[model samples]
Target: MSLPLYPEPVMEGPHGPPAADGPVNILLVDDRPDKLLALQAILADLGEHLVLAHSGTEALRCLLKQEFALILLDVSMPILDGFETAALIRQRQQSARTPIIFVSAVSDSETHVSRGYSLGAVDYILTPIVPEVLRAKVMFFVDLFKKTQQLKRQAEERAQLFREQAARAEAEASERRAAFLAEVSQALMTPLEVEEILAMVANLTVPQLADVCLVDRVTDVGTIRLVAWRGSPAGPVPLPELIADLDPIPLDSDFLVAKAFRTGKVQLLGEVPRFLDEISPRCDTGERCNRLVRLGTRSAILVPVVRGQAVEAVLTFAVVKAARVYVPADIGLAESLARSVVMAWERACLYQAAQEARREAEAANRAKDRFIAMLSHELRTPLTPILFSASTLAADPTLPEIIRDDLQIISRNAELEARLIDDLLDITRITQGKLNLSSTLTDAHRLVLSALDVCADGVQRKNLVLTVDLRADSHMLNADEARLQQVFWNLLKNAIKFTPTGGEIQVRSFNPDARRICIQVADSGTGITAEMLPRIFEPFERGQETSSEGLGLGLAISRPIVEMHSGVISAQSAGIGRGATFTVELPVVSIPMETGAAGPSSGEGGDSDAHRLRQPRILVVDDHADTLNVMQRLLQRLGYAVSTADGVESAMSLATGEAFDLVISDLGLQDGTGHELIQRLQWSGKRIPSIAVSGYGMKEDIAQSDQAGFAAHLTKPVSSQLLKATIERLLALQ
Candidate 1:
């Protein structure tokens, strides 16, 4: 009624089975203990599990506890004998498939053996069983049981090993995904220019994602450029062999790159060598297709790098070293990388454009400086004769009243024009920090009155009400008197020019504080707007209401002049249509009295016949005949012996034959330059005093003239007073 107890399953270890471990059970059933003992003794050396049962009921219980190799039963049991027990064992599903061997003393009859056999007994042993035969038969069953159990254990170990391998593989794949994304992020972090970025990206992708990679970009000229190319170590083909090296992909072409760019999509080509004609139908020679085949290219993908809606570049990858089929994952990675490259390229383009713009602005500034210098030289040339002739006529007592008045008008206007030209030249010099200033103790109030005198005509012409208030007690300031007067005149004239008819102009100067002098010029004229107020002092900047006649350099030049004197100039206005006020403040400092007497304004020389006899010989060279004649007459009037030449050759010829005391040569001759004329004169073994007179009067021009051994450099239209002064000084030094 109860099952036999059994120990836990005995497992085979790596070394050997433990002492208590054994094979599957072999159940021996009998009513007598001696018979069961005798059976166990026969199979004891088999090292198998032997579950003993003295009755058929016990044997059925043993079958419930453990699987058996075989069962030995006796038909001579009192109740539940071998045949009945075997039949009962068969009825139980767990032991139904188990082998059963029946042992009996009275089962020699055919009917009895048939009954036992019918109950699923594999064998029936009679009385007086042979020991050797029984042991051998039981050993065979024991060996079979051991092998079956061993097979089950081996199968379990294999299943566990497979699970571990699958887990390890999954972990490796996750790491690779992380590493791939990290590498791409690093590449984007340290960006080179577009060219270097493209090349680095191509190299990074090769031998990992693809056997070959090519990155192409669209140039500014609507052409494709091969930005970068790379191939795996095993497939060492030249990059030019790839279609990326071909001419720009035409928009109308059927080539893979063209198709991808045109549609702005990814294109996949399988069996690339064979399908080349299908994709690129215009391949007349098949040379490209054949080459790809030889290189083992089986597949490729052309991906367009799209930024917004426009395709900016293309990325091409091929499996050349080995045959491979690409999947969607590969295309996705390439697309991501292309986007990064596009961003880098756009940034690089902006950087390059900014650099180019900066260069252009610098070039424009340099040209502006040069133009100002040239303008100064040309405008000064013709004004010289007018000033000199006006001075000469004014000095003559026999001149008529009308003629003298006309001569005074010419002289005043020429001097005014010269001042305007000098303003322009000063602007250039100020911006370049080359303007030279000579500071002297000057009367500030007197300078303002002088500036007012200069602006009186313009004020009266406009019929404007002008008022002046000079309230400053300490008016003396150590400054360049000429330059300071120029500044004051510019401010006064600007007020007169801007004021309308009958409008009021006020000029006020006072000491705002003990250490500062403030000069304010206010005009009831077109006032500055808020928009134009900030940039009003900038060169060439003008208000909307002003005319474009003058170069708008008045306030631009005035501000620098004040600042150079340790002063500040500012403007205040209510708005347009209201009056505007400009104020200049200069730092007040103690003035030091000059110790030496001032030099004479002009050198002493007589125009008498006796003085003419000793006058120095002067040689004047110019390419213009009219200019040469005027210069000759002007020099002769100044009591100098003058010789004129129209060009460098004549000048050189004249100098060779004559013993001139001074050589005044014009630069830029028709035949050659004035430098050549001077060089020829110097080569003649004479230390002749020379002056460079020309339309080139830039600082660099002056420096070059000094280097060329000239005693002085003068711009054209030189005033007779200045020319005579320079000649007298040079002759005196000589």
Candidate 2:
């Protein structure tokens, strides 16, 4: 077998900086200057810094001042021999690793050679040394030191460049974030309209945050809507032309946008495969993918716009101009932008909803007011004549005793019917916040007694046992006395109505503390169930015990009245079949002693100033003939000259012909509204004092009446006494 030919080994110099500039140092230590001069002349071709020391002590002093690439010394010396000097040189930090060569005259002895090597000598040359060998060894170490310094310099330069690039990148990233947030904020301030906002977002982010952007939203019907899109700036056509052929991706589909929406997570694709067929097996989707690839889309991120736990939309970012990869920090910023978009969309939706609701509420209220007014007119028109005829018949003294008794019954039932109607109207006023309290310092105990007296007939009819304990002596409260009496009456009436025959109903009034007076009504009645206890005070909350026929508004009305007086009312019961206790607490206060007649009770008759005044002319306007006739007779009986009209046209005719001191008109007349009639009267230069009567007595209705120049507002089923008082008051004002 033939041996394979191999190239000769190359002899390379030690790697280092070029010797033409700063040369490396080599030390020569010898007692004889002639030998040093000889050694220097032979090694001068090496081009290195040569250092000389005459003795071992001189060599030690040289090593202390500077470093050397290599050290040369003669072994024989007078004081401080080469071995001791070399050992001391090794002890110093700067010259510890320097290479040393020893010269000797004697032939090589194993002991001498071993001792020189043991003293950290690199080489032991005999006398009559070859200069070529000396020069070659010295040059090798010098090259290594120079090469290390060069490498260190290159590393430092590279590090400075890297730091500069990093600082520039950080500054650019900060600027981009600031610009993005500022543009988005400006877009939000434009208008809350969703379409415009989405368009602004899509266009604003393109070529800045992304090369291309698309925004898609999911509709209420589970259908997707493409809000906005921006193609790459490199495209031959504009952004609209690029997106014109595209369609909304359905949420149930397997597209990346839909995936982000359904999963409510971020989807980042660093490299979208060039082949469309790999993305989808379907031919149609493959074609769409081909178009996107042609648009130069190489990378993408689909971030979901999350509102609460649900994903509302998806924001798509594509890099078309350059292939890019998103880092964790980039993804975090993308999600933050998605949050801003979600907030804008939600705020727009809420604003639209609030506007719609406001419009609907206003329309519904107008219709409700109209309905209540019409219904009141229809019901009260017939009741007016019934009440007036009964009153008129009962006042006739010449009638038979039996007939008089029957007439009395008719009058009583008619009055009772009117009272129920008034209760309904009161509930409407209280619920609509139209009722105002005329608060005064009054006796709570007297009001409680008065409420009991009103409920006396019902208690007797039911044969229910009643007990009274009025222990709150002179308990005066700053409250609406009439409203308080209504509260007391409601609780007592409920007890009488629900209690079985021979059942006990106890009414107790006492001061729980110095600041509060409490009234307790305990009854052995059909108790409220556990389920009903929580909602017992709610309006029309008649529980499963449905034996009652009345509208369940008594407790509902009582609660707000008590609350208006800074008081509280509560009910307690064990369960069904157990008795129930109702407690009402009102604040107690001091009042000055009085020696005169107390004020008349609410909804009661009183001496009027109208009786002292000359007979005043009055006009009654209503569409219902029965109402007109009844009102005319009642007012005439009160010694007023009264005129009646059936409609606005007729009323205007009568008003223009007659000089009336006061005008009382139904709000909803068949011809026109009372507001129109009053406006017409005012326009005609008439300043007659007017009162508005209607069942649509909400707060807004009263405000409208006041705005129309009506002096007072009264709901239908007005009492004869209340009407008389109102008429007298208006006449006095005139």
Candidate with best TM-score = 2
Against the unseen true structure, what C-alpha lDDT does each candidate score? 0.75, 0.77
lDDT of 1 by residue, 1-734 (tens): 01101112223334223223366678888998998888888888777778888888888887787778788888889877778888889998878867777787783568788987888877778868899998888877667666666665566655555556556555565466457656776776576466777777787777666777877766676656667888742345555554433556555555567667789999776667558656456666554344344445677878898877898778887786554556565566667667767777777677778878989987997798777766776677677667766877787899899999899789877877876676678777888788777798787888989999878877877899988888876567878888888888878877777678899999888987788898899999888898888998998776555662466788898888888899898988888878789998997666644569888656445333333467689999877665677778878877789988988888878888889999998887889887878877888897899999887776778888888888899876677778888988787765
Give the lowest summed-lDDT range of ten residues in model 1: 1-10
Q: Pull out the clashing pairs in model 1.
A: 30-54, 381-716, 381-717
TM-scores of the models, in the given order? 0.55, 0.60
> Per-residue alpha-carbon lDDT of model 2 for 286-361, expressed as tens digits?
6544435656667677899888898877888777776454445567768878877777878888988998999999
RMSD of 2: 13.9
Worst window of 10 by summed lDDT in candidate 2: 1-10
Q: State in Å the error of residue 474, model 1.
A: 9.6
